[model samples]
Target chain A: MTTTVIEESFRPGELEVRPDGTGNLLGSRCRSCGAHFFPTREACAGCLSQDLDAVKFSTEGVLYTYSVVRQSTPAFEVPYAIGYVDFPEGVRIMGQIAGLEFDEITIGMPMTLSLEPFGENEEGDPLTGYRFRPAEVTND
Target chain B: MTDVHVVGVGMTRFGKHPDKDATDLGAAALLEAVADAGIDPRIIESAYVGHVFQGMVTGQRILAQVGLAGLPLSNVENACSSGATAIREASLAIRAGENDVVVAVGTEHLTSKFSGALTPDPSDPEAAVGATMPGVYAMRATRYMEDHGMTREQLALIPVKNKANAARNPLAHFRKEITVADVLESRPIADPLNLHDCSPVTDGAAAVIVMSDRAAKKYANGRGVRLAASALRSGSVDVTPTSMTFEPLTWATAQDAYERAGIGPDEVDFAEVHDCFSIAEVLRVEGLGLFEQGSYPWAVERGEADINGRLPINPSGGLIGKGHPLGGTGVAQVVELVRQLRGEAGDRQIEGAKVGLAHCRGGKAVGIEGAACTVQILIR
Candidate 1:
């Protein structure tokens, strides 16, 4: 058997963008309380459970709500859309909306997550970022 | 526990002040409050100063300007609720016999901070990646719309009403009247949320003097309002999913204050709630048990929360119409309520106003709707 390893500088809990361009978020689940946490938690917030399991969350969800950013912030590109998505697992996550015109992102639109490069750090290192894109529409 | 009474309240005109430093504004408000109470500076036993980002020893620096040397000083940072928390701490200290007369002041000079970095760091996994305060609040507005079938026109009415009220308040930062169409057509910051829906970044300060009941009587002008209750609560690290719905900390804090004051939400004639965004005012009204779920907007639409409504809200024009100076907002809310209770709010006063409530919540850390919430009730 041959083991393959990819060499890359990544932050802890840094999400890997799948070859398909979908961004799957990795998180930790508390064994004692069945609580899910994003960006992973060392210990369970509920019941102080130390037993935790690593899990990959679905990269797709319905657009809960969103806002068009007419203003720019250092952490984000100007004229972007940001919103919360309601995952199938009943969890809500916040992320940037990518690959869409400012007027196109609407509430209740289906979206798929994608991991991309965030801006660099003070030291000029490329930082990986997570954002969501509109999913393909299907005929009912 | 001993009773605490409010002796004096002071506030700078809330607005953009590029010329003033936080310490300068804070010290000015303190001096005014102490003078209003006719208390000597040497008599203040302790002080609590609330500020968001004034670097190390911020509280000490502000008090030192007011001749407060070696007095017990604590800096509080609870986001928008910072001022309320400082006041609560000082009142508790007095009740516990730790001090006789204490001053609680809040100040913010945001013009000095970088406006481009207003959002929390998104590199951290728990950060609100794409959401600013307006974005989170827009979600609630959407939910409210879905649950009640409210229209955008109804939501726009909130800002219009608040701005109208603010026009009469000389101390309000934005005193210009705005119409529904003005709000509807304003630049959109978030979907369904226009720039008018949000409060502007402001620079100002507010202060209050709280003394033990005996001291208060000696200093008050025979009409000073009583500090009926003050309560502070922090978010729980663990809780059931429903706990997130109510934001447990705010609920608990309001409950504690209402119980201690022996008053329910219905008894409140008017309230100054955290309205950093228009939706926040709706949420706070519901969260504080003033109205049923999904009914806040209806209440607003029907003029139930207007200056002349059944239960006026933000009569001094809230953060949305006034200005949110971060640390100064919470204390300013209390000051507005005090003026109303004392029948001194002038044009923005609620007729026959007696019991008044003020709430402030802030801190946008991960997994928490708010890092802290403070509630206070006043009576004449």
Candidate 2:
């Protein structure tokens, strides 16, 4: 039996991967102005404060807008869905949409981050990247 | 302080030049501009050249080609606003009394440098997750349609209008007119946006000569047009998530220009905006305060933006109709404004145009609303 060994994360600065295949996108939370930024930041843009903390973003967000990219560069496969999702942290992050048809994706839909197998690394080893999927709903 | 006047403007025909490079196009445009100004090349006190992807010292090569070396030169790159920023820099030199005459040239051999959908820098987080320029604009188009009740057909009319105008422009990239149906039926680049809805990868160059009032008096011979204002702004990081359908950066830039020029949007006789995509035109005109928000699609249907309509827009064919060679696009827009303001636009001319405006916004970062935005106003 062969097991696919996956890298920790495709991009270390933006995402954190766990051994069990669960991870959170990383960003910065400004200590001075309480503003949030994705992929981390050295300082806060709103207040120009250098005091910031690296923080993990929530697992879920709301879809702001989306498109089915029928054309792209060679690095990405064609006809993939991409979108901007608005997090409660006040930052909007862009990511590929999976687990749904392109037509099913719409603005204002609830989404959750899902870590999946991305492209291969230099030695052809598998890498883990993040995608946004429909958020699961539960009722008590 | 000295006032600046644009005494001469020239441009290479905007289209693909498989045989030529950026240096060739830049030199040709610079020489034509110097000749149009009817001044000895020795009087050109300085130069500013704008481009992207072209390697170091492209300006030096261009100046050497024209036998105008040794003049102070600076190469500029601000993404799509590169050429416009070059003009602004030249005007500043004249305004500050550092130089009496300066030339601003913008050239790009984009065909050799790029193909397919342009993306943000590879390091961008968005570009990492499969983001293309067309994909970004298409998302905006989708939201715009939902918010403003804009139909697909209504949006298609923008390319139709611009291409019809381009058909009359002898130097335009796509001189053949296209219909709304053509736009709808074109190859899909992204949902809600097609190949025809986007600007073509083009290679071209344009140059303009700006002089201090003293030099203009000595040589303009009554053909000089006052460059009332040149305004530029970089996008501010969003303090909060804002609507993607609106452009605060464009508005801020134009506000500075209008205030500086003492001209209102209502007085703008015509304009050349950065219509890199069909939807971009709607955002630009409205962002410049020329059209009301959510009102441009209806205005296009009413023929209000046509050449002879109430307020003509993109009479130069725009980036959609004209070719978009990044750095060249901004300078070409000013050249179009100069031509139209001087009643030299020929078949695509707007009659008795006294005020002309040009707007260019380019580049994309992960969180900012836009990268660079510029607004230049000229008065005849």
Residue-level lDDT tens digits of model 2 in B75-103: 99999999999999999999888999999
The list of candidate 1 runs beyond 4 A from truth reads A1-11, A14-23, A99-109, A121-125, B114-117, B121-128, B237-248
- True lDDT of residue A95, candidate 1: 79
Best by TM-score: 2
Superposed by TM-score, candidate 2 places the C-alpha of residue B310 at a distance from the truth, in angstroms, of 1.1
TM-score of chain B of each: 0.95, 0.99
Q: What is the lDDT of residue B92 in candidate 1?
A: 92
Candidate 1 per-residue lDDT, tens place, B1-380, comes to: 77888888899999988888999999888988888788787889999999987777778988889788699899988777888999999999999998879999999997787462255545444343556667667666766676568789888888888888888799899999999999999988766788898888888999999988777767776756788899988875543233222446767889999999999988988898888778788778888998886787788878998898999988888888888889999889988988888888899879998899999888776555577888899988
Docking category for candidate 1? acceptable
Model 2 bad stretches (over 4 Å): A1-6, A137-140
- The alpha-carbon interface RMSD of model 1 comes to 3.2
Chain A TM-scores of all predicted models: 0.74, 0.91
The residue pairs found clashing in candidate 1 are none
Clashing pairs in 2: none
Single out the weakest 10-residue window by summed lDDT for candidate 1 chain B.
B238-247
